[model samples]
Target: MPSPVMPTSRRADGHTSPAAVSAAGLRKSYGDKTVLDGIDLHIPAGSVFALLGPNGAGKTTTVQILSTLITADGGQAQVAGHDLAADPQAVRAAIGVTGQFSAVDGLITGEENMLLMADLHHLTRAEGRRITTELLARFDLLDAAQKPASTYSGGMKRRLDIAMTLVGHPRIIFLDEPTTGLDPRSRHNMWQIIRELVTGGTTVFLTTQYLEEADQLADRIGVLNNGRIAAEGTAEELKRLIPGGHIRLRFTDPAAYRSAASALRETTRDDEALALHIPSDGSQRELRSLLDWLDAAGIEADELTVHTPDLDDVFFALTGPGNVPNQPKESAR
Candidate 1:
């Protein structure tokens, strides 16, 4: 078989790079129930790739296979430049994983837990202490470092879990539903942390059920459904894949509303609200043309807004009941 790892190339941002993670036709099954079905992925260095899906959609299974925590029943993968099957040890050394559940040892002090991770990575005692101190302070856990983790709030434990994951300085990190239970503020804070990691040249593989999380964080997103990738693209691109985009015009003056309604034959009229909905892709050219047409017709609208499909719309259309999966667009390397 050909190599799973591709050659280094330059990204649009002029960053010299190679694939941080790549896979092809990866498959896994639990008895008769197949999880991943011929899945493919290519994530570049220093980028975030979010896999989005509902529960039991194989997000964790894919993470396990790529992270070498479990073996795939078929296909190949390379992570951090090491062939997954041939050099799992090397792959393990270059990646860190923080699963959906917090890995904090609540019975121990937060500092002690950091020290334990430091030891697992085989750092010298002095080195361990130094990293543990820096990480705890960086994560703003210094005040609670000596306190039992059981006393920490949900957000605190989550932060501690990530700090522990960073103790090894892995280039690629797999975060499986990292913000599942975090409050809004905590979730935003975690998003900032993920951004900083990418800024510092770390590749992140995130799996999330939150459409907003995937929309905000991922450079590209792959929507998984029924053991397959329903579609894959940037948030805007995926949104464009579905319909329901339009331009809405509202008028306070009854005469203007009637005039516009008479002129625009294709618009859907809302007599009660004096609003008109015109089907549109909401592109710049379309908006300009619409404005010109209205001006020519001598019609003035009090309020105008363009409505386009968002990630939530894209998700439901692609993965909802009775929906057929679209062939995934080729992902950028």
Candidate 2:
């Protein structure tokens, strides 16, 4: 398998470069209720860092604060090498944002939306047209450049939304559920676009309700619960935090199954299926140990399979009781 892409630049000594976004003691509140309670983050440049949490868990609040849409009640933040509080303009210039809703102007042509974004960025008329054409073509909307955005499909409109965000060529992007309402095919396409952005040296800070989206895209993930980050790590590292991982051995011969069960004291047996479930983290050492034990007993059974807790399990364990945001109300169909 190809190795996963590393978003951050590393030094010769193996330490990471300076962070693209950093926050210390970030806090926010509305009226008597606190939304974020002193959270800190250090996201390296050129990496995809996903922040996950249930609805109303302050995920949106955190994004709003970081993106300069709202001020934090307490704490400090820097984005793309600019101090968020002191230089909001600089921060704005260095980052792009695609929120939960589409920003495209449905009444206007797709090309017009891109041009509007270019105009907002102050690109000259010729330059605006150049970049507009470029982005429209890049997003595969070249043929539909003159069509009203309202006429486009959900996926097409989303593609245009992101295309507009890129008009400024910001180094860092904040994607708030970019794939929330997209079809599987569209969502996959968005994933590819995100990967391409990171590959080209852009840093992405993503917030998503989809666990699989985070697993597939984020180099590192942070689980937010109760206004704080409950856990943070690579997908596999996070999976290791939860229990229920195991290796299962199945034997066709009842006698062989019983003999193996006798040798292994710790196992969950299924007599009907002649299978033994051994508790394991599914690590290499455990697999080798099981094989060694079986060889010593001169027992050759049938099949072996390993099972590990997926991100969905980890998300539930850390976030407590909450439904994963349902697929968008509208189907891809």
Q: Pick the candidate with the highest lDDT.
A: 1
lDDT of each: 0.90, 0.89
TM-scores for every predicted model? 0.91, 0.92
Tens-place lDDT per residue, model 2, 219-244, is: 98999998999999899899889888
How much is the lDDT of residue 255 in candidate 2? 95
Count of backbone collisions in candidate 1? 0
lDDT of 1 by residue, 172-226 (tens): 9999999988999999999998999999999999999898899999999999988
Q: After superposing candidate 2, which stretches have Cα over 4 Å from the reference?
A: 1-13, 321-333
Q: How well does candidate 2 match the true structure in TM-score terms?
A: 0.92
